[model samples]
Target: MLPVKPFRQRTGYCGPASLKMVLDYFGIRKTEKELAVLSGATKKQGVQDGEGLVKAARSLGLKAALKDKATLADIRKYIKQEIPVIVNWFSVNEGHYSVVVDIDKENLYIKDPEWGYTRAMRLDTFMEVWFSIRGNVPSSKEDFNIRRLIAVEPHKPRRGRAKKK
Candidate 1:
């Protein structure tokens, strides 16, 4: 008999799984000393971008779910082996980092409202972004973190510099 689990039908998102482990895994307010330990070697390096953890996870095998259409079982199984997460450091107005969460109806749930990239998204629209990021889904690097619709005001810069500077 197959094992029955809660949230069995929903396609659990891998984004949060890996991210949760990444940020929350280590000690809070990590000192430069502590951060150095994570980076390896014994050198006091200034805040390196948070890309390292996400990069390492991909090497281990974590992928994104397309169209917000992934199975909770599949995600759970994946997480059991290794957590999947996304690393986003794009924030001009808000925090650069955010963890992707679940999807319901058509909106992609996310942690940290500051990013303001994906206030909300349609399932179909998000899928396209997801697929676009990785080219294809369910890959050997099956787990992936996606950066989608990050609102960068390309026009705003020009707005302030009007009338010929």
Candidate 2:
């Protein structure tokens, strides 16, 4: 299993919370409040787009890549490398963000911030929800057409930080 820290978002802070989970896995401790400010998220209006999430991750010195029209293979590749991915998909007729931690032959393990737990779903089911968007507009049933994917890669830590006295 990937070393992902599960976090439940506060109000409309799902973006920040998801990013927080990724940051935590890299040994970077940052509060959701700080991430909200970095991502230009407000109490009333949370992160507006994937760009906000990219900007927030970049601010912390992590490499954040936003992929458009990402495929299931892309997600599986990242999971194989032990990198959790933040995916924007619709769940329960609502637009949401969650972390994809593991993928087996038949199922995908998702760490949903809103639900505060890891849920498993078949690959076909995940794809249906992930790509079910209407035109370019985002609604309850179909949220956004682009199907954006965010992958946060951590930089290798320097090895000379501690010296023997």
Candidate 3:
């Protein structure tokens, strides 16, 4: 499992905060504010999609892809590769982004920015929350599937200080 630090989201900055945690795991250092600007996150709308996150990751020299219609198997696959994924879920009648850090046969470990901590969520809960954004899409183009995620390719650590465990 990655030692990804959680950031308490400032207002509607969950998207940027989640991205920051994933980037941190990949050895990419970026502030949440910077990520917010790069991801076009605003208090009014937050992050509408993962495209901006992909762009931000690419601009920071990491490969990132926005994927839809993802499943629990996909999340497990990425975790096995030691790459944290940024996933969108429905909570409190709105969409939010959280980082998937690890997984097991029955539980998925997630670092929730809003909660400011990492916790284990049951696979059943994962299925429900991960695929719960059916009719609450912000746009037609984003309506392909509510199971959206940002897959970022992990790279070697920078030749500086190693991340503390």
Best by lDDT: 3
lDDT of 2 by residue, 8-118 (tens): 889878778899888877777899999999998776556767778899899888889998789889998888777889987876654567899888889988888888888
Q: Name the 10 consecutive residues with the lowest summed lDDT in model 1.
A: 1-10
- The deviation in Å at residue 104 for candidate 1 is 1.6
Write the residue-wise lDDT of candidate 1 on 103-129 in tens digits.
455564444423322344455654544
**Sliding window of 10 residues with minimal summed lDDT for model 3:** 154-163
Tens-digit lDDT track of model 3 for 123-158: 888788774343455466545347887887745534
lDDT of each: 0.31, 0.78, 0.79
Model 2 vs. true fold: TM: 0.84
Model 2 worst lDDT window (10 residues): 156-165
Q: Of 2 and 3, which scores higher on TM-score?
A: 3
Q: Give residue 82's lDDT in candidate 1 (0 to 100).
A: 30
Better of 1 and 2 by TM-score: 2
Runs in model 1 deviating more than 4 A are 1-22, 25-51, 54-97, 112-118, 131-165
TM-score of each: 0.31, 0.84, 0.85
RMSD of each: 18.2, 4.8, 3.2
Highest TM-score among the candidates is held by which one?
3
